[model samples]
Target: MSQNYPNILLIDAIPFQGGSKVATRTLLHELTTEHQLCIFTQTPQSWQGLNARFYPLYMPRWLINKDQGIIYFIKYLLIALQVLLRKPSLGKITLAVGASGPSVDLALYMLKPLLGFTLMQLVHGGVACSKTNARCLLRADSIHYLPSSRASMVAALARYGITDMMFNEPRFTPMLNGLDKSEWPSEALMHSSEPARPVIFWAASLLKWKGLSILNQALQELNASDANFSEQGFSANICYIQPKNIALEYDEPEDDSANIHWFNQPSNLDEMRRQSSIYVSTSQQEPFGLSTLEAMAAGLCVVIPSDASYWDLALIDGANCIKYRPGDSQDLRQKLEHLIKHPQLMISLGRHAMFISRNYHAEQVYLPQLQVIDSYLGAGSSKAQASITGVF
Candidate 1:
């Protein structure tokens, strides 16, 4: 309750744990130093800290339960308005959303005038893929996008006939995702700064688009090769973690890389990272794969899916990281076998990945976003009239 500090409302609309949650917390960690923060999240308090008043959807009433909740979003919409409206005396109100969702974003947009707050949205690949995100971009006072996402979003707005307005201003800006090393579970931290064996790591919430099918088929081919003879088989264990329900229900492929298995997301991600020396990302539209960065930061030899979407990530395929064909199972299998055959390749690639990953740590990535927020919240700069209005 510092009287001198201004108030800002940070909203996280998704009701679960994911990359968006990580981004929200990382930004809040730094922003709290200068503002009186109000975080509205659906994640239970046990999962992470809340610096300001935390409003979650975990009420005792079954109707508000996250399982199939629609009414609760409306409830939260009201609560967000209430929070902003409650204190007219507080100076310089700002509204920041973790990721724009229909329920929260629309409601807040309608209330922006009544509540007297400037709006900012964090666009995490959603804008490039959906028209809804384009609307979110147009309505907001400012936008924070991943380095790869900024160009795509600007292009999207152009397609919507917003070319001149969007490019002329700093409305949409690039901001890379970052990690707080200390936020990871202490027990899951690697015992030594070296890689562990018997586990190769892959994870994605959206399995279908992330190329999980291709991974299985490729690993299946690898398993078949192993079945032909003991000498031809692959080495190393692989663990794939899919966020529950988001993944397509895939039956276990036969023998099929019998070493590879999928499980619900782990409570401690560091433990998952520690148990593996190699990490692979099969996502096709990965604007900023936060998990990929985490694996690289953990010193894992990371292989990224070969596709144009990955271009801006600044990953060097042959040297710093490995790039496998987008959907070619055979190509993936060959790459896997090569890594299995050459242990030194894993070490070298892993070390380089770790070195390259330094440029994207939270300390480095979140600075631009902070500067944007600070400028928007500053008294004189933010008073200019918004060119775009009305949600689509």
Candidate 2:
């Protein structure tokens, strides 16, 4: 690798591939051409195809749980120490440590000064108000947060007595998750005629906040309302990945409805989206809702909860998306029924959504943010500083 190319190291403590990891993967894919990239992750297999060096941190199921406080830290320390000993030159070569959240990479935060790397913190969800987290955020060279998380992040900082002056402009920036245009279907596929029976797609981790139960109730009601629901109602494709170590209020729905299918973390989710006509989001106050954005990009008429989330605010109901009352399964059922009754409206909404998705292409959305990262890495010219002031 050329010395002029900045070495960017991304730390991923999470073992599974969630929205946060997906967003990180998208950004890193875009950055491959301009910089030298490496990933330190517990699950290296998840990042197999990316052109980056990988340092696997072996973590068992017990040690990986966030609830294991001191034991978790000690296990991480032992594994990280082994890696450091093997690759001492990493300290001098790395230009920045990219953390997915405020405290996601706690070990990196502790070793940042010794390793001589700048910190770039990306807030994917609500900021936890804790002294340790506040200290990590304060030390970060740049903090990129979603618009929805701004209030919570500010409040968290305030709890630690951090003044407004300390967390302004270039140091703190708001960003949205973007879609990879190459991964989506062609325009022809996007504008294809509506399917004979619309496929209603719902995908997310089976966490309580994701509202799987609400979707189940809505689907059940929709089925019960019509005797020939299997033939007249939409075909439902429910895809979910069970989160590790999280307690759930209800088990997965066991409806024997012929039209409903349950998929457990399908590998070809994009293909599934391509075949679907409508995408439903049931998350409660989602921070960024990357899956919802991707569904829009895939030309699916999205039905999202009207909870003032990032997507709810970005998409106009009946124009690009349809919104139902938050936590109201009956309302959600009604919305689905309305769309089923009017197929053209669903097609129109999807077309409009596909057009809007172009503006959020990863290359266009992440360029300015990447410039800010490059500036800190001392790889780009002074134009990056101008981007810092203008972007946000």
- TM agreement with the true structure for every prediction: 0.76, 0.89
The residue-level lDDT of candidate 1 at 64 comes to 40
True lDDT of residue 381, candidate 2: 35
Candidate 2: deviation at residue 202, Å?
A: 1.0
Candidate 2's TM-score: 0.89
**Candidate 2 — which residues are off by over 4 angstroms?**
1-5, 89-91, 185-190, 245-256, 381-392
Error of 2 at 213 (Å): 1.1
**CA lDDT of 159 in candidate 2?**
82
Report the Cα lDDT for residue 296, model 2: 79
Go through the candidates in order and give the C-alpha RMSD of each one to the true structure.
Answer: 7.6, 3.6
How much is the lDDT of residue 383 in candidate 2?
27
The Cα local distance difference test for each model comes to 0.60, 0.75
Best by TM-score: 2
